[model samples]
Target: MLTAPGSLKAECSNCGATHTPLWRRGLNDKLNCNACGLYCKLHKCLRPKSMRASHGEGRRSGASSLASALSALASVAAPPPSSATPVVEVVSPGVSSAQCYNCHTTATPLWRKDEEGKTVCNACSLYYKLHGSARPISMKSDIIRKRSRHDARAQRSSLTEPPSASNTPGTPSETPSASPGVSRRPRPV
Candidate 1:
């Protein structure tokens, strides 16, 4: 598939052009056949060839080969981008790297494998903990962050305050005021 420098002549299947690509340089230069003006690109199949021929240019096999070759290159090249849509990773279990199944995120620290073996991230896990169910995918991160912060504050309060003074449901003395402008329950100080 490769040859010494200046010795990479390949006959284009589409254009029938004899091309000598600088294979070492990995250039996919576009070239036209001198006899018929059939265009070819030489990259992997040598000149990224376009299988879609011009009117009366060439057979469909050449065009199909070009299209297939380009698609194969695309599939090989697209993975490194990490932001491409429809990303499919073949991650093995027990590997340090893992994707969160719930949010499809790869932040490992934020993810945990739940009892059902699905990966759930921090916010999703907390949602499950609080609701005894999976968090809806439509749940906004901002709201979840706010709730997480509130939960953290409550945890701190519970550690420092007496059980009776904690304004829990059993404590009528610490109940929030029933004033018109006041909210039903005051947020923890």
Candidate 2:
């Protein structure tokens, strides 16, 4: 049971048992496990509010969420009864038989096992046939594809482009070619 106000239950660091929860002292940061009489070593950061795999180091346990850790500390009751079935009426459909692997839709009129041996629904199968790629993100974006194509063209051009002394960087060309087919000539005298 949590004793201090705003204090949460913490598992015994030594025995790793939730039944023997300990209260942490703010000043010295010591764990007071009354059940096991386990006291955290007096150090700057021996044991933080968050539990860790090892004494002070190793991966931070329950780093994903403190709520999850708290939930784990809470006592869980027994699960409810089973045998809850959903009722559905099949309309003027073909003999609904196969169980889909992907969607898990039972009594599917038409279902087939995928290469990996998962049930695939009829509509899903048709959709997959029309548009490949399981996850949309798995397929390269159109913008990315276009950009890659442009980059490939640029790379080929760069490789094929002969080295020239005129177009060198830092050293500006004598005159900027004003327009195509119009050469820079001396002004009319």
Candidate 3:
């Protein structure tokens, strides 16, 4: 079976999945499939065996999935009118002004609905989902952190490069542990 370059062949101890987009370490440093690892990390328990999918099951190519999502969004955003006359919308007191219910912020990269069907900002929604509690107002910041996406070609090139005589497996290389200008920061709760 074809696999991602630079990825080692390993079976997940939890789900017995041999193919995964990314491999992660789980309990006792055992290798785990991507889905199992993320689920275990979030819930602090093993993923249910029933959730495991068979080979080549429920997999959609990125391009096709993205196209379908865009088309669906377009259809929902602008539906064909039944008549030539334009529809007029009346503002109601019960209607929200697209502001986050939790943080009351009008600006957000994306909007999401909470468990109560209340509108919330992307950060607030994700934070609540992970923590199982409303995000603290004190933690809200005006600045949205920007993350740099590394080029896949550059990473592949680095991994595919041949080992030099001085940089053999036994000998330590002079390169830094992390790539230049990249900083790993802890996720804020």
Off by over 4 Å in 2: 1-98, 135-189
Worst window of 10 by summed lDDT in candidate 3 = 52-61
TM-score versus the correct structure, for each prediction: 0.25, 0.19, 0.32
Cα error, candidate 3, residue 169 (Å): 17
Model 2, 101-132: lDDT tens digits are 55545643456656687777655565677877
List the global CA lDDT of all models: 0.52, 0.49, 0.73
| Model 3 C-alpha lDDT per residue in residues 1-189, reported as the tens digit of each score | 334346665677886777777777888877787878898899988876546544422234567645654664565575677798667677787554588899888777889999899899999999999999999989888888765556767888889998677676656566666777654444589
Candidate 3 whole-model C-alpha lDDT, 0 to 1:
0.73
- Candidate 1, residue 109: how far the Cα is off, in Å: 4.3
The candidate, 1 or 3, that scores higher on lDDT is: 3
Candidate 1, superposed: residue stretches over 4 Å from native: 1-97, 140-189
Give the candidates in order of lDDT, highest first: 3, 1, 2
Evaluated at residue 74, the lDDT of candidate 2 is: 49
lDDT of 1: 0.52
User: By the TM-score metric, which is better: model 1 or model 2?
Assistant: 1
